[model samples]
Target: MLQVEHLHKSFADFKAVAGADLTVRQGDLVAVIGPNGAGKTTLFNLITGHLTPDRGRILFKDVDVTGLPAHEICRKGIARSFQIANIFPRLSVFRNVQVSVLSQKKLSHTLFRPAQTLVVEETNRILDSVGLSDKKLDIAGSLSHGDKRVLEIAIALGNEPELLILDEPTAGMSPDETTTTMDLVKRLATEQGLTILFCEHDMDVVFNVATSIMVMQHGQTIIQGRPQEVRQNVTVQEAYLGGA
Candidate 1:
């Protein structure tokens, strides 16, 4: 569903992404895993238009999306959640997602329409999908850190994206919370048929939920393969897995 080829991006003298290539097929739960400074986030930024690449290509469903503006790319069916929870903390959980649904439907400025009545079902459905329906009326700022992250995912789903990019979807979660979040991710792919690409530092989470894994280091892809293969790779062991 998405293809990134030999992507290179640099900041003056720092090469954040140098020759990174990745391919994510439809219904894929692809995980990008690497140690710190591996440029996983930079590559994601390039693909999602947060950062323009110095050179290379990003193709989504066969169309070149490289260098498109972030909003334009989002309109083209790619939605992302950041490493940090990005949501309207002051808004109710429902309102937070409602805004995204409204934006997606181009109804954010319907002055004559009562915004409360707009996309009610859509917002509720997204909340339900992310297991946040019970918290729909709560203030977003009051949610637990893990639920806040799930709220971010729900907000991304408001875009109805064909490709969902999650940056460290389980970061900062407790053990049980990590399990729950990753389980939600698995269901999104297996049951809902969503194509997902995520970057994570949790080895257990990556190995347990990823259909495939790509390891990166020093701004480049070291290898991409099934989890078992990656776990056993000599270089991966030496570089990041600590020979485990």
Candidate 2:
């Protein structure tokens, strides 16, 4: 559960997030949708503490986390994936998730500890969850773009986050790959009850997978409603859906 009130962020003369307000309740798979330069990614950055807001407040699980560092946000049960893949290229797929697991346990300094095989089972389980069990031995850089995205999600899930924020989870995938990845996301939200807040440009993905939708424009929230409500909203249609 998260609540953001009148969040404002700016860079010199340009405002990236201007008085944006959002509330993500438990069990809500919320879609953040807007055109390019609508501050969607900037909003996520603000929420995750990658960029501190100039004003307003961010409350995660009823605790004010405004301006907390990125690591602190992750430790507090919020994990995120980026628009671009972020993974260890040379590490094996299994090792990628293992690194996150070790980091979660504060044991990243113990890398290459053959005597301490502590995260093997957890890493295997995480790889299996992401459908990468077969490729666990392969180098992460060798994976397809879609598998890489799945791996990123696995890494984010390594710490068992309560709220997962995905920024453009299907940015560069083939149609089939996009379906597979988004289906995986949907299953996590529906079957595993993982709360998700995703920013997506794909209208089909947004309408099909999200329970609720938030439309942003000019660095502000313009619409927040159920899927159907967002679909038919006149303002959203004029400002966002129409262009998309």
- Candidate 2 per-residue lDDT, tens place, 1-244, comes to 8998988989998998897888899989999998898898999999999999999999999999999999999999999999899999899999899889888877755567652476888888878877999999999999999999999999998877889999999999999999999999998888777899999999999999998899899999987889998888888998877733
CA lDDT, candidate 2, residue 144: 94
TM-score of 1: 0.96
Q: Look at candidate 2 and give me any clashing residue pairs.
A: none
Q: Give per-model TM-scores.
A: 0.96, 0.95
Q: What's the C-alpha lDDT at position 183 in model 2?
A: 92
lDDT of 1 at 138: 98
Model 2 lDDT at residue 206: 93
Query: Each candidate: what lDDT?
Result: 0.93, 0.90
- Summarize candidate 1's per-residue lDDT along 24-44 as a digit string, tens digits: 999989999988989999999
CA shift of 12, model 2, Å: 1.0
> Which stretches of model 1 miss by more than 4 angstroms?
109-118
Candidate 1 yields a Cα-based lDDT of: 0.93
Q: State in Å the error of residue 244, model 2.
A: 9.1
